[model samples]
Target: MTNTNSTKTIAVYGATGHTGGYLLAELRRRELTPVLVGRDADRLRTAATAADLADADIRVASLDDHDALVAAFRDADVVISSLPAYVDHGEAVLSAAIDADAHYTDLSGEQLFVRRVFEDYSARAEAAGITLVPAVTDSNLPGDLLGHLTSRRVDGAAEITISHHSRSGGDGSRGSAETVLASVDWFREGGWHYADSGWQTGRPPVAELRYPTEQPRPASKFPLTPVLTIPRHSAVSSVTGLLPTEFHEGLKKLTADVVAALPATPDPASDLHYDLVVDAEGSGKSVRGVLSGLDSYRDSALMAVEAAVRLAENTTKPGALAAAEAFDATDFLDALAPHGITWRIEEL
Candidate 1:
């Protein structure tokens, strides 16, 4: 990790959003400087002030202007995007980062976008010698890494199931709301899951999920980003992600008007709890890995910033990668322990 005087620069895209504020604060806390790059100059300045980085470099670049985005990241060693709805607005920054010769990571949870990053940009990123890792948030990071760890424990998993559970003190931030609303059509349809041959949509019966001390509940198969990520680096033939079926039903009814009425950000005291459970089974044995954390948004920031810092060290292989593919699964998960995020693997 770079200290106060280190010359490594991290460029943060979407520096004006709610999660952007957390990313900037985390970068500052780690004694690394952030170059705020976003579409709005005034909002960037405000975010800078709020992060106590009033003197930090600020670059104004809209996503539409590819050249401008490239210029904004020209001096950055790594670019970490905290933008919401990556399915709608991720490629520009990703393209720009490769153009600027900077490694990239983002807090994307969109399966479509995550798939595109690897399929569309993997060759370009590899040719550019820069890493591009998407879906590094609480939603997918733990699941992907844990999928890697638990699968190995069973000597190679033939089937892997990931379950997601989240608790928030209130409605989440506007960005999260927007992400859900924007992707509801696909999300509610039981987005892509890996099967024996390839990616498939609408796989089977509702997923049966077992949380701690609770009876199995039926969870809808959701577009968990890891379904796309894990297959890239792991040998899992089947991967399924489970979320509350009710959540998908609710999204079936969500509308722009309803989302517009939401608050722009989470309250100062609003607490968030997230659990990512991975069940790997094969060879008449099973391994379960549970990754639990507090504050999805805050922990996501930590995950992205840590990815940037680690990528800045230039040790990971360059190309479109998953969190586990880029770093040691066990070491990376263990590193998050101090941040109120923990992972444990046990025989079942």
Candidate 2:
């Protein structure tokens, strides 16, 4: 089921935003031209021009413009979405993809939205014969891949913990900030975690964690998309995702003013380093693994593009799927070798 054509046309729904620009640039770097779709024609033009994609095709369509949106994706092989607050905009674009019979992927980190995609749209996508993969970015996939890798080494892996650490100091991308703000109530209400053979609620807030380089920090239990993703393939009885206490508190206190004050662009000179440590324990033994990467946003862009390319080339089952479930863990990480992402499993 490989794509016989030399290039596959990918439609990017939010191709004018910051991360969308990276996706466009990555597509161009790989010589796969993209159809730029966004609400602002001028912003799309400006982004394409800045990315040196002056000749790329551009499509202007709002999410509400279902006819135009469907038309934009009609000729494409896949659609990669960078839209934020996905709970609001995701369904429309996903519906467009299904209507167009195109494979779909996105960078959504919202847990509820992820679950909805699987529950509500999986049957439709399967019937349409198109794959739908949500949470295809760094926020979830890296830890997901590590957890799967760790679980593969430990038989009857009953518990898995994913811890995140980053090197940068300021707020993350604007899309991320907006998503966090949109889901503030969910975060405060204590998000869901997988435990006790089913979804659990109201878990403890924080726990002590020893990172690879830093001392012990009070990591807060943040129910990221991994809680839904990891359990899709692994037989882990429980999964917990945590963020640094400082980062988690800052996210809780994020105001519109703070989001507005965040830099319009990331500091290029200041490298963003992300580390994920996954501990899978069961059957009286344990296995641990670590994954480290630079530039979470750019890595996600690369990941989205790579996943699109692979879907266009390989035979992918049609259904709602997680990143690790959709792609081979080791092969996917190896494909990211050129981007300076590394991982390893350790015996314990």
Clash totals, every prediction: 0, 0
Count steric clashes of candidate 1.
Answer: 0
lDDT of 2 by residue, 262-336 (tens): 676676776688877887888888887887888888888888999998877647899988878789889998888
The parts of candidate 1 lying over 4 Å away from their true place are 1-6, 267-270
lDDT values for all models: 0.85, 0.82
Any residue pairs clashing in model 1, and if so which?
A: none
| Model 1 CA lDDT for position 53 | 92
Count of clashes in candidate 2: 0
Clashing pairs in 2: none
Identify the candidate with maximal lDDT: 1
* lDDT digits (tens) for residues 1-348 of candidate 1: 222335689999987887888899999999887899988889899999999996789899999999999999998999998777888888999999999999999999888888899889999999888898889988698889998888888765458888877765235888887887778888878789998768998756654788766678767888889888888777787998888666776786688888888888877666578788999988888889998998888899999998898898888888899888898888888889998898899998
Q: Candidate 1 at 312: error in angstroms?
A: 0.5
